[model samples]
Each structure stands twice: as structure tokens, then as C-alpha cells.
Target: MIRLSQDNAKSLLAIHGWSGALLGLLLYAVILTGVIAVFADEIGGWSSPLQHEPATALPKGLGAKLAELSTQVDEQYHDDLFFFPQAGGRIRTFFHKDIVVDGQPSAEGVEFDLDPNTLAVLDRREGISETIQQRNTAGALSAFLVDLHVRLHVPNPWGLLLTGALGLAMMVAAVSGLIVHRHLLRELFTIRCRRQDLLAKRDAHVIAGTWNLPFAFILAFTGSFFSFASTVGIPVVAMVAFGGDQERLIETLVGVSPAEDKTPKPLADLDAMLADAHARVGVEPSFVSIAHYGRADARVNVFTPPSEGHVSSNNLVYDGATGAFMHQKPGLGLVPSAGGVLFDLMGPLHFGNFAGVLSKAIWFALGFAACYVTLTGMLLWATRRAESQAWQRLARATIWVGYGLPLSLAASPIGFFIGRSLGIVELHDSMAIAFLSAAALAGALALSLRDLESLRRVLLAATGAVLLSLPLLRLATGGPGWASAFASGLQAVFSLDLAMLVGGALCVFAARRPNARLAAAARSGIEDNQSQPA
Candidate 1:
């Protein structure tokens, strides 16, 4: 009876440990990536020296740029032309369709990176060339990175599903973790690293997990919300509420479009439409939406920036034909609809995009802490599994992949510079694939090594060396040096580069830690304690 009870207890404890540890790994990746990506724009600014434009730098001449665009349209597409001005910061061209030059669309439209003073294309199609930047604060690389983190660079539906599952797993681990550490709340502020490795692991887990419980819950729940909607919400809601009709369910939740019944009419002025929308919103316009522009029942929707103590109820809809206000979308008031309010706040809460630099800095700090939690969790697991050769190999492989991924990601900018120098356009996708392949190779090599400590040391050393050289490498190329980045008011680049160097240095410290050698012995002692005859 005693033997059976002990065996059952051991099996249960082992099950819980492996489950929590495994799930924690994925959660750590998602959270860490999310935190870094919150300041995606800053990272992008750091990556390119050309992006370090001083505020005092002349705003690129709008008229000449517009004229150049018009000329491009005339040469390419002879259809009716409409010019869209980009938001100011970096520059990139978005080709608008259906512009006419000679009553036909021309085939030769070129988006020129214009010189700000002359409004002429930079036209430096040579070594270490620069592309025209966009007017938006968040540039293409930032946007792409955000998308990649959230969606794993997959299509919308599939990515959401995968991330959602990960979120669910995170929730499970967090909840179970809380339950497992009943004294977590009491020990929340403590850091008990002085204890032996097992107790230290428990203490670290409790302290980090307890204090950040709210944040962990929020990230997991919200992440799961979108994912659950597709995977679980749709099916349940559709079946129970709408008799299994997906379309009707969507319409009920989000509202359905009315049927078109009249002939098309001349479209109203977008500028005027915006003015009318502004009047209703009590704020300047940030986004404009137009539907069925040439029809009598056309609609125009304009959104404004959210204000303090307001839950961002800043949209105004109008009849496109008459420029008259339509009924306001529900959930804009002080006491808004639950679903709408949640959706509205999701963007600001997740990315800190709505918040300025200070807020983003806090978000980044939290993100680094989250990464710390993840790394510690993995290390703790590896300590427990140190005696198992196969498991040790697997754990080392995971560390290599995790560490190598970000390092490889850092290398992409260098790849971009090389591609530009080599006259290889469309290098982004090619470079990403190559980096991924290389990271895989690094992971395989690390796994193949017999000594885990040596592998960790090698990977950590390589990461430190590569990161330390990045800024110098940039300067050696046509890219800006550290001083130039500062001169151009690009604090993000300087800070980011510095952070990378510091992070690499820390990894080296961790890799070289002498005390880490005794982790396996400590784990063995604990396992023996639990297994010994009582």
C-alpha cells in the first residue's frame, strides 16, 4: 500500500512538473517577443542609419513630392488620379490604383525616395543605398515584425488559432502554477536565490509568477479571446445563439450591411466628409473609411484619437452622398458596450502604440522581466533533467534555438545592408529564410555536443561577439555611426544597440557561472529525498 501510494504521488508530481515546464517555454517565447516588438518602431529606427532624421531637418517638400507622384501617375496610369499623403517619419510608397494620364493607365510608375530639400529622388542605386522613407511613425519593418510576433508570420486565421492555443496553454500553466504554490501571494516580493537550487527554483517561480499574475492573466486571456473566437467562440455562439448559422451570428454580433437598391450617384468630397466627421467626433481625424462611394447609400466613417479617461469612442459615420451624419456606432460613450470596449482597448494595451515613449519603456521593462521568467523556468527544468542524456540534449537544443533566434533576427539588418550593396532587391524574405536556416543549424550543432555547459558557453560567446560588433559594422558600411544616431535624435537606435550589448554580456555571465555546475547534483539529491524509504 505504501509503495503504491508513493508511486502514484511521484507520477502525479512528475506529470505536473513536465506540463508546467513545457508550456512555460512557449509562453515565455510569446511574451518575450511581444515585449520587444512593442517598441518595434524604435528598433527599426535603430536598424537604419538613414532613419535618424533630426526634427530640425526640413519636412520633405509636399508640393514637389505630390507633383512628382502626379507625374509618376501620368507616366504609369492615365486613370483619374488621387494623391494620398503619407504620415511623417520614415518614407515608403503605397501605390494607389486607378489613375489616368492619357485616359489609360500607364505601366511605368516609380516611387522615388526624394531628397527633402530638392524633392528629387535620392537615386543612389549603388553600394549601401537608401530607400525613400515613409511618413508614418511605425515603418514597414516594425509593422511586419509586430505581425510576425502575433501571427508567427502566418495568414490571419491560422496564426490566430495557433497563438490562441498557446495562450490557452499559458493560462493553464499560470493557474496550475498558482495552485501549486499556495504561498505565492505571501512571497510575492521575495527573490530567494540564496537557497539551494530546488528551493531557489521554487522561490523564483513563486515570486515572479505571483507578482506578474495579473499581467500574465491579461496577456493570456486577451490573446485567447481572438483565438477562442475563431476556434471555440464561433462554434458555441453560432450553435446556441444563432441555430448554427455563422453568417447570421456574425451579423448579430457586428451588424449586417443593408441591401443596395438605388442607382449610383456622384460621390461627395472626402475632405468635406472628414470635416463633417470631425465636427461629430470633437477631435481631429486619424482614420477615414468610405463604403460605396458613388452610390446614394454610400457611407463614410472617420475615427479620431482617443482622449484621456475616454475609452476611444471616436468614430463618426456619414452618408457619402449627402455628407450627413448617421447614427453613431454603439459603445462610444463613457459606459460603453463590453465587447466594443474590450476590442477598442486591445490595441493600446497590447502594443503600447497609443502611449508615447515613456509608457513604451515601461512596457519594454515588463517584457524583459517576462523573458527573465521564461529563461529561469527553462533553466530550472534543465536542472531537474540534467541526469537524462536525451533530455539534456533536448533542453540544450531548446536554449540554442531560443537564444539563436533573436541573435539571427538582429543579423537581418546586416543582411539588408549586404543585399542593398549587392543590388539584390526583395532581400527581406530571402534573408529571413537564410537566417532561420542558419539558426536551425546552430541549434543542431549545439544539440550534437556532448557537454551541455560547453555548448551553452559557445552559443553565449558567439551571441555576445556578434551583438557587440553590430554598431561598428553599421558604421563601417554607409550606415550611420553611434554619434550620428545620437545627432539625428534617434535615441531608440542607441538604446537598442546598447541593450543588445548588455544582454549579450549578461548571457556570457550566465553561461560562465561556476555555481551552475552543481545543479544536477542538487536535483539528484531532491529526487533521492522524495524516493527514499521513510
Candidate 2:
């Protein structure tokens, strides 16, 4: 146990309580959304399942397709090329060159979506990168959820800054909680449900919080690093080390070619190079980026997921002009330096994707527990001061958000299905409308209810009902049925459908469970500290 004097402990407790009380709701929203976003790829596949899973992200004959498309686009776009898999195993290929947009360098390109198996062009778009990104519809559901977690849907820099501050506040609370909770080990198993109702609730909060402290710290630190790296860290470094030349700073850090060579050359076959990379790395490539395509100084980088027993993947670089292997390099630098090692470790550590599905499941469970602890802790604090009208209002708001948020999230898929069926161009707007509509309903219910028990039961039931209907809605909107999906080798769709059904059932069960203690506490009218049990 961490030993502290009485005064020190009191101060630490104050810090912990206030920090959580101030940012608890927003932090809970982030953690809960992140838990779902961990399965973003699976969600994308489930929402937009293909006829069959592809054998590889980059299939044979892709080079011919690229060459044919290259002849059609503007010559300036020949400067750079990128390819990656998108929702439902569709491959997205883009050819672009840098152009100034509002004093910033941006790509103007033609992007094509192809069927991984047939190599048939599924869609084509041409515009500035930003506009193209805004118009792309693949993985719309997963993208919306991820954006909510990453930025709360606010504009960049400001949203990133707000989330970064929240991360720091979470870190402070986690550390101070450790210091204040003197019996951490004992508290791990403690649940004093036989005592007073308030004590039991408080003990539940403490136990979960203690078990979750380490994970909370890990998430906070990594989350803050990601949020600030682009918005603040890179710019600061550019100012100090590169004289504010962000482009040059990136080139140096990423080990780009130092010499300039603009002479045109016949581009090597990318399909052959991809095969070579898979043979060397023992895994399928995830992304391929080419710079200065068709030029003597051209370079190609193939990025793969981590190999077995490895914490991070080594990116394979090749001479784009010759298709000859250059070197296998870590993510950040040419050689594995201290900074590179740390930077490479961050992705898997934060994402918990190092061990695949099992690790992701564990992270999701821990994240859910963290959300529970936050909500329960805030409720307990407000309940203790229930004599004050202001504190009572705070309690009502807590219940509205804690129970209401899930209902709103479950409602978003409904809008997604509806919009897709009608071929709506702006599905995100549809989702936002559905989510807010649910929230408004929940708020009205919260205001009308006299007690927390009623509000919880209603919201939980509503969420369960919405989740239960989602699969049916998906089916009605042209999504594959279970049998068809299974026959087509689309197990992701089947698994997600089953998971949603199970989740809905569990929520319904919880809503219907008898809560004797809450009923007893309500009957006693014990809303203040004066009603402590002997």
C-alpha cells in the first residue's frame, strides 16, 4: 500500500474526487466509444459484407489496372500513388500530387475503388483529398464512431486539444486515486453489499476503480500522446529543429531520399513487388505507398501487420523504379533508435491489437468497467450531497447521460440503414439526427421520472429494443441474411448479428432484474449523509 500522512491523504482524495467530478461524463463517453471502435474493421465488414473474403489486399493483375488508370488521369497525379483495403475488402487506389490549398499542401487526385477478386472498378472519384475523403461512403458507421471517440466530432486542433486535456485530467485522477485508496489490494475484492445501500454502491465503485487503475493510466497516456502528436508535438518540433519546415522535418524523420532525381523512368511492376514483400514478411501487406512514381528516385513502402511473436511490424521498402528490395525498416526512423522503438510500440499498446481478437476483447471489457466506475463514482458523490437542489439536478443529469448515451449510440445504426437504403449522400447527418432524437427522448423521460430506478429501467429497455431491431433493419435494407452470409464466407456479418442479439438480451435482463436495495433506499428517503448506518 502507498503510505501517506493524514493531511497528504486528504489532499489527494480531494484532487481525485474533483478531477473525476469535473470530467467524468466526457471521459466516460470517450472510453465507451473507444471500446466499440476497437472492432472498427469488423464493424465495417459486417455493415458492408462482400460476396467473399479476398485472398489478399493487393491481388494479381493490379499493376495492369494501375497502369491503365494512370493514363487517364491528369499527368500531375503521377507524382504519388497509394493503395489500401477499405470496407468489405474493397481496395482503394489513389494517384495524386501535392497542390497548395489555402496556404497548405494538399493532394489533388483521382481515387478508384476496385473489387479485390475481379479487379473491376466499383467507383471512381476525383477531387482534392479533403473533399474526396468527405465524400467516401465506405465504413461510414465505423468512421462516425471513431471520429466521436477521437474528437467528439469537433473540428481538428480544438477537438484534439480538448480530448488531450481530458486525457491529462484522467491521468491525474488515476494517480491520485491510487494514492487516496490506502487498501488497494484489499479493495480489489471488497463489496460491502450487506452494509448500507450507499456504502455498498461506494464499495462497488472503489473495487472496480482499483482494478481498472493501471489500464486507465495506460489509456490516458497513449491517448494524450496521439491527440497532441500531430496538433502540438509535430509543429513544436518543426519549429525547433527544422526552422518551421514541416515537410522537411517529415522527410528527415521518415528517411526519405535526400537527392532529387526528376528524370522519368518506366515504373516497375507493383504486383511483383507485393508478392516479394509477402514472401519476405510472411504476412499480407496492409498498405502500399509510392512516391515520385515513374521517376528515377521513386520509392515504394509496403506496410504489414505485426508478424507472429513481434510487438510491431517492419515496413518493407523497395526501389520503385526497379522493384528491387531496399531495406526492412521500423516505422519512425531508418534504423531502430530509442525514439523509433517507443513510437512503434505505441500503436499496439494503445489499440490492444497486438494479440488480435483476444486482446481486443480484453481491452473492451476493461474499458466498459472504467466507464461503469466513472458513472457510479459521480452518482455516489452527488447522492451524498442530495440535500442541495443543485446536487440533485446534477444527479439527474448524470443519470440522463449515463443511461441515455447507450440508447443514442444504438439508434445511430438505424439511421445508417435507412440512409443507405435511400442512397442518401450525407448519412452522417442522418445518424446525428437519430442520435440526438434518442437523447432528447431520454432527457424527457429523465425529467418526468421521480426516481433513478425508473429512469434506468426505461432507458435500458429502450436501448435493448433498438439493438434487437438492428439486424432486422439491416436485412430489410439489402444486407445479407445469416444463411447467405455464412454461405458466402462472410462470418463477420453472422458474428456481429449474434453479438448484437446477445447484447440486447443482456440489457433487457438487467433492466428487468429486481433491485431491492435501491427500492429500500428510496423508501427511507435517505438522501443525505445524516442517515449513515450504525
Candidate 3:
């Protein structure tokens, strides 16, 4: 019994330490990416402002432009084509196929270019040029960062598995963190900075962690669900618990695919289909998925945006070839299907994008708080044992990872713009080079710890400068100026630019703090506020 207890105790400690350390930096990255990703559409819109600008109306040859590009891509790539007209503010063309490329099948992605007012391609020549290939959408960077946060951008399964491991670790840390600080509930909202320094540090951690526990828990759980579906076999659980059959199992969990057709005739007029779907759902149609086009019985799935102040499992469907209403399903209810509700809640709850501008702003605030929570937790771990060289080393490492990640990430847009301006043949390669280089430099600086305060000030100043230049960059790239963006209701770019400017100012304020040794010591509860670093 003693041996087993000892083993369990060691295991628990290992879980606490390793999980907190492993996820702390990555969680910070995830929170930052997620907050930015909430406006992915806006960023994408900003990148191609021409698509959303006030035109007299959509150009007359939208169909011709799509058809021309479709033929070129289909002939060249030999794949099924999906054309998203006015998708997230730009037209995107996807070429999909099941074939081995570089010894890997299921290699899928889209080739996109700006929509042309004339029937000509956005670029001079066809075949996916460098500009069209570059993806600098508002949410693109955030999504890429999210990929880093979740799977470190490895292949799909591998990234999911690793992230799942991290999620499990986080679950353990959260539970343990709650236990470690259980006695401090009465002090949750109170911060007494004048108390003993260590008490003050401890107090800050307690307050931030406690007040935001609910939001943190929700984020962790939802993030885990995404990684866990693949790792923990939650889908398998759905299959076994609900029924033995896979298709039926999916249906029970998410929703039944109301009857589909294999030989559906070609859809006639999408305008008619749109009107029919709008009348049924009373919501603007977001996406329309057509299955088995050019057949006798075609199914067109129209998705409705989640309603305000409510989480829904409802999806409205219509027949494409026939223009008939198929079915309407509500997402959450008494005895709601677990799989269904989870599927429905994934986008809204995870990204907080469903509630429009105010909700998204609130979501962004909470996300930043989560980032601070993760940072503070790691700092607490290091400061408690500040005398140890190992602890000091780790503290330096965390500072680099935290501040440096933002620094490198903030430089990516500028990198993209630079690469584009320089006429780089391959945009992704240019972006990769830029991001990796910045990250490497940041990591190197982190290790040196030459002068932590100096580094912090430099990074803050750099971030501030980079953020302040966004609007100017937009104008330089033929995008509208502030007056035009405001007049056209394309405020996403201006809004994002202002947020970055404000964020830069905050960094400046933080940098104004006395100095590094002093900051570290203050954080460690080892120095008097009025005193300088020893």
C-alpha cells in the first residue's frame, strides 16, 4: 500500500509539473491565435478589399469569371471543383481529389485569387500565381498560430495526438491548481500589493486564476474535445454507445443526414434555391453544399447562423435540383444527443464568433486574460523556487517564450507584405522563412537573457511600431484609406489596426516598469516596491 501510494504521489507531481510547463507556452500561443482568428474573415477581407468594396453591384461576369477559372483549374489539376462565390469577402476555388502526391494521398487544399471585375483572371496569367497562392487573411495568421497551438503544425493525426496529450496534461493541471489554491477562495477578488512581496505575487495568481476559472475550464474542455475526438476515440464511443453501425452512429450523435441522392440532376438556379432556403430558415444562407450534381435527386444543404442569446443544434436543408425543403433540426434540447450538441457548440463556443461584434470583443478580452493566466501560472512555478539556478534559468526561458512569440508573430504580416512587394515567386516559402527567422531570433535572445528589461522594451517598441504601420501598409497596397473604409462599412481593417495600436501602447506602458532584475524580484516577492534590484 505504501509503495503504491508513493508511486501515485510521484505520478501526480510529474503530471502537475510537466503538464503546466508543457502547455503554458503553447496555451499562450493558442489564446493569442484564437483571439485573432475570431476576425479571420475580416483579415481575409482586408487582404482583398476590392471584393467587398462598394461597387455599383456585383460585376456582370461573375459567372463567366468563375467558369473560366474553373475550366483552367480543372484541366490543369484534374480534380473536382468547388467554387465559393463571395466566400468570406472573396471568391475561393477549391480543387479536390483522391490521389497520391509525394507518396501521400488525401492531399487537399484550395487555389484562390481575387475576384475580377472583368472576366480576366486576377493575375496576368493563369495556374495559381504567387499572389493568389499567398494567404494573408486576417484570420489566416491566427489560424496558422492556432495550428501551432494545437498540433505544432505537424501532419493532421500527429498534431491532434500531441495536442490531445497536452490537453490531458492541462486537465490534470487545472484540477491540481484548483486543489493547491482551494484555501484562498475568500481572497479571490482581493489583491493586496502592499503585503509581503511573495504574498502579493501569490495574491495576483489567485485572483486571476479564480475569477476566470469558469472561462478557462470551458476553453480547456472544448479544446480537448477537438483533440480528443481523434485521440480518445470519442467518436468510437458514440458508435458503441448509440449503435454498432458507423453511419447511423454519426447520425445519432450529430444528426441524421436526411435522405441524400447519388444521381442528382444539375442544380438549375441558385437564386431560386437561396430564396426557398431563406423563406424556410428566416436567416441569410451562409453556405450551400451541393451533392451529386447533375443527377436526378440532388441535395443542397443550407446552414443557418446560430441565433442570438441561444446555442442551437438547428440546421436547415433544401433540395437543390428540386428546390424542396428537406428538414429542419434544432441543436440543443432535453435529451439532446451528446455528439450533436458537441458538434453544434464547437464553432460558437470555441471561437466565440457567433454573437457578432460585442461578443467577439468580449471573447478577445477573455482570451487575453487566459494568456495572462497561463503566463502567471508558469511564473508562479518558477518564482516559488527563485533561489535555484534551474528556476532562474526557467524564468528566463518563459520570458523569452512569452514575449518573443508575440514579437516574432507580430512581424509575420510585415513579412508577408514585404515578400509580396518583392515579387517572391513562392509566397508560402517567403512567409515560412520570415516567421521561422523571427522565431529563431527571438528564441536566441531568450536564451542569452543579456538584459531582460532591455529586451522587453525593445520588443514592446518593435511591436508597437509594426502594429502602428498596418493602416499605412493597407493604403500602400491600393486598399482604401480611413475615410473610404469608414464610408464603405469595411471597418474590420481599421478596427484591427486601432486595436494593434492600442496594444502597442499597452506594451509601452508595461516596458516603463523600472527594470528587469527589479521586475523579476518584485514578481518573486523578494523585493520592496520602493527598492531597486539587489
CA RMSD of each candidate after superposition: 7.5, 2.1, 5.7
Clashes of each: 18, 0, 17
**TM-score against native, each model:** 0.73, 0.95, 0.81
What is the Cα-based TM-score of model 1?
0.73
Off by over 4 Å in 3: 1-18, 54-88, 95-143, 231-235, 238-264, 329-339, 515-534
For candidate 3, write residues 1-534 as lDDT tens digits: 122354555565556666777677776676666666666666655654653453422234543454455455443342344444342244444544445545434434346544534434343222332233334342244445455667776776777886666656666776655654535567577776775555566577667777776777777777777887755575577567856465555565455544655552455555565666566655555554544444455455566576545665246656655767766654532244675577788767877767777778888888777777777778766666566778777777777777777776677666566766676544555556767777787777666656555666666666666667766775786667777777767766677767777887787777666554436553554333233211
Q: Model-by-model lDDT, in order?
A: 0.58, 0.85, 0.60
What lDDT score goes with residue 132 in model 1? 20
Query: On a 0 to 100 scale, what is the lDDT of residue 415 in model 2?
Result: 82
Give the C-alpha miss distance for residue 56 in model 1, angstroms: 13
| Model 2 C-alpha lDDT per residue in residues 1-534, reported as the tens digit of each score | 889998888788788888878888898888888888898888888888788888777899988888888888987998899999988888989999989887656889999989899999888888998777665676688888888899999977788988888899999989998878888889899999787777887788888889899999999999999999999999999999989998888887786573879998867988899999999978889899988877898899999988888888769999988999988987886788888888988888888898989999999899999899888877776777667788778778888999899999899888888988888865788889898999999999999998888898889999999989999998999999998998888878989999999999988998998666655544443443676521
Clashing pairs in 2: none
Pairwise lDDT winner, candidates 1 and 3: 3
